[model samples]
Target: MRPPVEVCVFLLSLLAPGVLYTLNNVPALQEPLPILGIGMVVLGSLLLLLLFIVRHKTTLDPLFYVFAEFSFTCLVGLTNALEQDGFISNFMGFYLKKGEPHLSTAYAVMMSYWEGVVHFVLFLTMIRRMFTRKSYRSLGLLWAGSSIAHQLVHVPGVVIGKYGSSLRPAFWRNVPFFLVPFWAAFLLFSRPRETPIVTADKIASEQKKSLLSRPVDLLLSLLLLGAAAFSAFRGFVVLDCPLDTCFTYIYQYEPYLKDPVGFPRVMMLAYLFYALPLLAVMLCGLNTPGCSWMLDWTLFFAGAMAQAQWCHIGASLHSRTPFTYRVPADKWWPVIGLNVLLAAAPALLALRCHARPAYFMKPVPKGEANHKKKKN
Candidate 1:
């Protein structure tokens, strides 16, 4: 049998966003939002109509949630493209970029394109079911984490820079971007909590565990913790630098630390804020049995680290920064490799969590009486 009506509607919903995007940009229709708003209504009506025709209950399945994510990413990707290309007609780009002198600079352009590319890749990956669940979870985490980091860069740049005076519109327009990933993350982690029944003998037999039972699992957990440390360190380094210094040193390395028209400093602050808390949870939960939530958290951090690293590394390499301050030749491979490892660590950790989830499974006590008491 075909998937439920929700799945069909979700498939249809994907097309509507791109169609609305095109309609909004039509030359004769100088004002696009009214039309866009109407388009949303029409799209909603269509989904409702589909539900009626199918005679099926409205269900919020995993694929449906994935559709929501894909649609939003596509819309944002369109706007990012418009902003970077200096399209005055696009209301969001005009207002947000016009106020900020940096939006026009090369660094802003590079960052915008980078975000657009990342979002686009995610869009394709979700729609295509291009990866295994383990791989998909990794991608989802990377997307969620990166999205949160991207907004961090956006908010501080708009508020602290030229757009500071006109905060209301920019803040509201940016709300959905910030909100969606959080909701998605929650949904992704919401595997139902259930108590498993097992005999005392079985539990005892399983408890005879070896630390090295899964060498790869232990290694990934350590790698994730290491990456978390690096992320925290980077954030602190960014914030500690004097606002106008334009460069900061962490140990012997001096990477670009300027905020530019964009909020590189603020972006780092957001990364640190989001990463450290999540990392803490993951570490405490690392050996935690039945901590399926760790899988979701791992995905989220993977995205955050990947995006934050991109912003940091991209800023340094951009022509806007002095070439001398870019990753030095001697440190090129090491620095780039470290960043790559940081991004990869979470993905690997996520796979480990999924594969060996039983390793972390909470021990179930024997007897219904005890289970009921524990529940009570």
Candidate 2:
């Protein structure tokens, strides 16, 4: 069977850019803006025509929009890789060049390679959701969270580095990347909550002890809280906290902390916000039986933490940040290990939530069921 009209149109919209990019390889309009304009115009025309043709056939699926946004994000990431490879250097490499002494070239190259692989996987995930009609709620939330985190860094990184004023096309084009993912997240959040299967054994276990009462759970919670505190403190340091001994040590030893512009600074703020609420929710949440939102929150945090850690580790150890902030060689093991742990914590939480999902399930509200019945 064919996919829905909305799905087909969205897929075409994705392919349109590549066709335009290839067509613009002609001799007349090789320059970035002219080529970009031609591509946008063609893409716009195609979408308009498709919308007209499919107006009656189109079906609404809010989740599909989220997947579509992710697919686009992957395309953007691939385009970034091309820019790094000098295929679209003029239009894309400005920020990479400007970030030289401040940002790491090694990091950028690695990030490009990483994005190329990741975007492909994400695109496949979208295809699966579209054609197979399967639910990947946890994965969906992770994609949304990571997209949001990446933008949190990227938007500021561009504005502060070379993009300058918000008026520039360079700056404005990126706005959609941020907006679409956030809208996707909101759509996912608004969906009706579901109840996981609850068995007699699960109920008995819940009555036995609080989730946090376990030693491992308590340890993980405290560690997560500590990491959140450190993130907030480091963000403060980036914003020019008074240079006391500890701050001096951070600036000297953990040099990325001294990012002149607010790129890493802004990212840290995003991480801090996610981490703080996450830590609080997890702490209180472990004890509260069957809070349906637990699964959603876990998935979101897992995605955010994974992306934030990726950015952090890359920014710290890779080529961009000033040499002063580089982690001292002697401390490498401890520092690197902690960052990896930070990334791993949320993934573990998401897995745990998924495995024993009944702990976090919530019953469908009577009103919603009644409405569904009436509609049927």
Candidate 3:
């Protein structure tokens, strides 16, 4: 049998960047309205492609069209980052200028890189997993969390930032960015999770250990505490906390939090409201037995942290940001180092949760264990 239609669409979608590059010079698309027109054209093309495949009697897996659409965006993201960095010119200039002007910011550039490089690889891997008939739930959750984090901050940032007044017809294209992740998360979470196979004896033995006994867990707990504290500090800083430390840190350490673009401030608050509490719960999960939720949630948080930190750091240092808002030269390492650690903590925690999941596994009752053993 021939390869699936998805495989063909994937190959065809690689033409997006080149096509866009050629279109950049087209005078017809020079105006702001062309962005909306371009969006419509893309939508039409995708619909046509889908209809063609259906006519050929190919079975489409759930989210087949979504994946096809994202395949095109992956290449576009690379082009966006390249155009922003000046390695390529005019590729996304029109989009940046009128489509979503906020994308010209340093934070958006870094986010573009994440979406281009990291998320592109993830989409490819997920596609491979789907075609291979493997369980991709864990990977799906990671992508969902990361994509949701981007939309949550980005959409709001644009609405409140200086760009809010300048939003063009093309800006509405972000509607899918906001809706798809939540929908994907809903779908992924609704699927029955594949349970980790581990014995009750192993679960008990692992969970019985104290925090001090597990050196890695202890380290992660301390780091989580530090991250939580940092989140609170930044959250306060953004809220105009009257304290001297908050004032000093905002002006001297990370003035990016005060940028009129509003992305950094929103990101800090998100960490405080969502990530901080989750970290506390995860810390508890580290200490408490039978917190099976840690396995998936940890991965989700890791993806969010990774995406948020990447954008935050890039925005903080990007030349596009005003000098006053960028990290002070004297305080660069401390700010970046802390952010790096924040990104790393969740990743390490996720790995630990997956590596030896028995610690987090729900303990089987003695009777249940005996019955299962007898049946075996």
TM-score of every prediction relative to native: 0.64, 0.76, 0.93
C-alpha lDDT (0 to 100) for residue 118 of candidate 2: 61
The local distance difference test score of each candidate is 0.57, 0.60, 0.83
Q: Report the lDDT tens digits of candidate 2 across residue range 1-376.
A: 6566446645654673465355434546554455446545754666466556445645745555445444543554566556555566443333333222222233344445444456446645655665556665556677777777777776666566433443233234566667887887887687765544454455446546664566656666777676666666766766667859447746555666555545666666666666767767776676676676778888887877777777678768754455666687777787788778878877887777777776555544556655665776
Please give the lDDT score for candidate 1: 0.57
Candidate 2's C-alpha runs over 4 A off are 1-36, 42-73, 82-115, 161-167, 211-213, 243-245, 320-325, 362-376
Candidates sorted by TM-score, best first = 3, 2, 1
lDDT of 3 by residue, 306-364 (tens): 99998998889999899989999999899999999999999999999999998888888
Report RMSD for candidate 2: 5.5
Query: Which candidate leads in TM-score?
Result: 3
Candidate maximizing lDDT: 3
Q: Report each candidate's C-alpha RMSD, comma-separated, in the order given.
A: 6.9, 5.5, 2.4
Cα misplacement distance, residue 328 of candidate 2 (Å)? 3.6
lDDT of candidate 1 over 91-172, digit per residue (tens): 3333233223345444455556665566665655664452222234455556767776677776667767654664442244
Q: Itemize residue pairs with steric clashes in candidate 1.
A: 141-299, 142-303, 145-304, 146-303, 289-360, 290-360, 290-361
